[model samples]
Target: MRDSIRLRTRARLAYTACRRTRCSRGSLRELSAVAVLITALSSACENPLAPELCGAVADQVVPAGGAVSVRVCFNDENGDGVSLASRTSDGTVATVTVRGRVVTVTGVRGGTATVTVTARDPGGLSATVSFGVIVPGIVRLTDRHGLMPAWSPDGTRIAFLGRVPETGDTGDGSIFVMNADGSGVKRLTKSISAVAPPAWSPDGTRIVFTTRDFEIYVVNADGSGEANLTNNADWDVYPAWSPDGTRIAFVSDRDDDIEIYVMNADGSGTTNLSNSHGRDDWPAWSPDGSRITFTSRRGDDIDIYVMNADGSGVTNLTNNPALDLWPAWSPDGGRIAFRSGIPFSADIQVINADGSGATNVTNNPEYVYGSVPRWSPDGTRIAFTSADRNNTEIHVVNADGSGEATLTSTAGTVFGDHAWSPDGRTIAFSSNHSSSGFHVYVVDVSFFGKAAKRATR
Candidate 1:
């Protein structure tokens, strides 16, 4: 009986090999009769030279600069020794290394790559499994108090308010410029009391900022031409430059009550856009220079309002009972993102440009407050600051209220006033994670993949 089974097993193996090699259909039909009779016999005496691989062969997503390990089980049917090797499809996207049965992959950049692991036996039988590797994570840029960073129009440099450590006076802050990677940090304005974040001109040559004395100032990118755009005495602040570089919209109480005003690029042609009885501040210009958005208190609640560039057709974009402030226009001008809920306990909310489709993005129960929801230039993600029970950290969420990620993880530190680089590759923000005072920081936004939760100090 054993001899008969052995013969049947050999015949079945030969038939399978013939079919795999696309033999004639007549031979296949002839083998079909024997295939059923020898199937169990072949299974009992399978070839040992053939190699088999076990474990997941699905693609993996990894953050840039992060590593992931995949363990595969390899075995030979004949009980012979098996070896494994690993390789990457693109070395620039990721690197792969083999150690026994484990394959380690390291991401080198922010793109898709494939990894192939092969198991081979001494009998010349080999099996290969291919999977994808993706790398995404955050890169810390600065270590100092770099508050309210604004990217240049060219997306190469960043301008922010740097707190001069202990200038021996009440006002120690100055307007500073640095490369987008947090290098070449240069103080652009010396001996001036800069109180607000600087806004870059459309041409990238000038920066407009506000002072503690309620005045608007503009300085050259190299700190050469420092001029006060608004020398008024009625607290002019929150200057926003139009997309065309033709006008700047700011808030001032020069009209007895705080209201939205627009001035030319050189601080001329000042006109009140929202001359409401309520206080309106925090003016932000639309990307097309056709509209301006600001926060107002026209009713019992603080809401977001929008108006034409020429200070007409004022419309309330967010008229909820909850205070909606810090209105930021998306790059496409289709939606507006802002902060809602009570003070110090707010969430990031987005609304349509026409005052519709309001959604709460960061619905964290422990959230104390969130601030400055800046949209990426691509208009896909929104970066902001949120504080929980522990500390205030930088966070980012998708435009449709998904993929909430915490970017910073310094206990007890406050990170706020974030600005996205024009390419949407990095986020520049203000944080005191390194010391007692807030400093500027730039973190790669693309690295918010699976490895983003790893604390970046």
Candidate 2:
């Protein structure tokens, strides 16, 4: 009923606005007639999109230490009710408050803050309108194909890989790093051999990555001190750091097949954890630095396996024929996420640490191939790389596999694995965004609309 009334009102207003009139402004009598006609027409029809009146903080500006007054605009569109409610995208609302069309912000650090406004209907039962607040200098990192983004623990920077063709590089490979706001874009590593799968250490200090040879190499975040951790010339790759910053678990073919191995932080003490005769790879450590879980081909199928820290007591967890690989543990050490399938027909799957009930959380058939699953620090969502029939993009889904959405587009080819920041607000992945070189890219994962503000600066 409300929608009908709103639509009729809009139609009548549009008709009056477009009707021939000597004077541009309509008189009170004409307005009243239009309103009456709209009300009558609405009462006689069924519709949706009830006109709603809402207000939101549209502007926010803060400097390093000063407070900024926020501006809230009164949205009279479709005029339904006036109950106003607002929230910060990060759920921290002390920076701004809303009442009617006015909003005041206090105690904001010089940068950008986002506050959202929503209006409830007269009945106070449903939200009628919504909008956003934006400021400048707050940079955000995003990509057409960013996934598995790993942030340096210091929170000052991010490193991922991407490809940008307009920059004259192939959409197929590159490695890059930039400030948290998407500035200071320094391409750290470049190669025509197809570089992908980058991971950072727990100390926010060093980075380990993989190239076409499946060998892992460590490089200083500043693009110096590059060293190949797996210099054996075997197919060894997918390096993940231990929680204590003392070891890196990666895959290697030194055993005549792909297997998970651990080494000292400095590329020493290399030992195979999944000593099974079959292939095993993708080792991720538990949060406490105790056990490691990975995928193995020992059970005549690709499945998840867990073992102790010292490459002992290897145990198969998944026990299925679905071909599960790329197992990532939740930050809390409760569950694990992995990718499974027939090459391009893979999806993100999750299971408990004990392997008591595996579920394919991302059950979407649309994701013909989904790989490289990483969980946010808060354990609320999982981000992974996915490809459809037309293009490849980084996608996120809730822990329960609901609310699946794409973060990147067909702007370029998005290949390789990605790492998620420990803070869970950004992703670093490799894409051909610039095309000049395969550089790592960062995308803001902040719910507060922080990326746009950073870009304008």
User: Which has the greatest lDDT?
Assistant: 1
Question: lDDT scores for all predictions?
Answer: 0.78, 0.65
Instruction: Give the per-residue Cα lDDT of candidate 1 at 173.
Output: 67
At residue 195, give the lDDT of candidate 2. Answer: 63
Off by over 4 Å in 1: 1-144, 165-171, 447-457
lDDT of 1 at 138: 45
lDDT per residue as tens, model 1, 363-450: 8768865677889888888988777776777777889888665555555455547778787877776666665566666666654443
Question: How many steric overlaps are in each model, in order?
Answer: 18, 44
- Report the lDDT tens digits of candidate 2 across residue range 1-457: 7787667768666656655463344564576676776776575454323333333223333322223454433432445555656666543323656767565554332233455555555534344323333222222255443433456787677666555553666645455666776678666666533365566777767888887776678877887777877787678877889999899988888988778889998999999777777888777899999999887787468888899998777777878667788788887899998887767677788888898877877776766656668788788889887777765667777888875655554356566666666567666665665555334455555653233331110
- Looking at candidate 1, the ten consecutive residues that score lowest on lDDT are 448-457
